[model samples]
Target chain A: MLSKKAQYAFRALAHLVEHYDSGPVLIAEIAKKKRIPLKFLESILLELKKNNILESKKGKGGGYFLKKDPSQTYIATVIRIVDGPISLLPCVSLYFYQRCKNCNEKHCGLHDIMKSVRDATLNILEKRTLKDLI
Target chain B: MLSKKAQYAFRALAHLVEHYDSGPVLIAEIAKKKRIPLKFLESILLELKKNNILESKKGKGGGYFLKKDPSQTYIATVIRIVDGPISLLPCVSLYFYQRCKNCNEKHCGLHDIMKSVRDATLNILEKRTLKDLI
Candidate 1:
């Protein structure tokens, strides 16, 4: 399941996507619109900014905006940026691969099955962009 | 990602599946073979037992075993029993549905996309069983 942080990030991004051409949106506006807490959204947006998925301005009329077009931003990218691995098992993860203890990847049935699950999930998330979300 | 508890449950169940017809297998044997901590495996097995997926025996030559045929035990069932929901979002979940906060389910894009993802994942997990894992 996606964490609350990841879910909030998606909600916040979707709000930004709606205002993609309208310039920056205040964090307070997004929090109010999406029902995300203001303090939680501040950190989430900051993380996105650090990852270059978003940009911000300061002072009067200052707020946040997407760094890239919504069409160019994939759900998979957002998930990875905020929620980490998409795979259920570390051994099956393509982007965050780690050897599972006590199992041989070559012979593990769970590995074989979970790898298929990861591929199926990625097929959707990688193909769907933020533009598709709106 | 699968929780450590869920992963350990799967690993322990896989071990049980391998020794299904050979009478109850010792907990120590499963722990050592699967690299699961003995105490953790005990709780996992007990949970599976409560879920009717496993049963145990006591005294000499006693241990835990699958309550049903491996072929009849779906991976989806195990995951739900141990890990709760399979879908990325609560709104998209079939067995564990919950309305997402501050979102209209009918108009939510994340809900729509995650529903597709849930379907794709269930296609694999529901069809695959403990038998396949062996």
Candidate 2:
């Protein structure tokens, strides 16, 4: 399951994608429109800015905007930043791989099955971007 | 991520699947072999038994065995029993469906992508049975 943080991240970014050319949108507006808590949405957008996925302006008319095109910002990247691995099992994860202590990878059926699950999920997430949501 | 309870449940059932037709196996043996804590394994197996995936023999040589053939037990069933829904988002879930509070299903791209994810996971997990693990 996607964590609440990841879900909020998607909502916030999608809002930015929707208003890309309308100048920086305020945090309060995104919070109100997305139904995300104001404090939490502020933190999420700040993190996205720190990662270069979003950029912020200061002073009058200041707010946040996508630093990269929405199509270039993959959902998989955001999920990874906020939720760790896309894989259900650490052993099968590409970005966050960890060997299972209890089983041999050569023979473990669950590992094989989970790898396929991860692959299927990653395939869609990597292909789709925030633009797709907008 | 799979919950710890679901992981323990899978370990316990896979142990049972391996020992099927060889008589009931002790909980301690499975716990020690699978590196799962004894108390946790006990609860997990009991849940599986209560769901009819397993049965206890009682008395001398008593332990647990698959109540139905391992081939008849699906991983998706166990996951659903423990994890609620296979979908990443509640709106995409079939058995545990709920409308998203923040978005319209007709226009929400995240909803569409997650449906594909849920379908892909369900296809694999429903097709592969406990017998496949053994």
Winning model by DockQ:
1
Structural similarity to truth (TM-score) of each candidate = 0.97, 0.96
Clashes of each: 0, 0
lDDT of each: 0.92, 0.87
Q: Write the per-residue lDDT of candidate 2 for residues A82-132, one digit (tens) a residue.
A: 878888888899999988887788988888899888888888889988889
Measured on C-alpha atoms, candidate 2 has an lDDT of: 0.87
Which ten residues in a row are the worst by lDDT in model 2 chain B? B1-10
lDDT of 1 by residue, A1-134 (tens): 99999999999999999999898899999999889999999999999999989999998898999999898989999999999999999899989999977788898888889999999999999999999877
Candidate 1 per-residue C-alpha lDDT over B8-57 given as tens digits, one digit per residue, 9 for 90 to 100: 88888888888889999998999998888999888889999999999999
Model 1: CA > 4 A from native? none
The candidate 2 chain A region of ten consecutive residues with least summed lDDT is A81-90
Highest lDDT model number: 1
Native-structure RMSD, model 1: 1.2
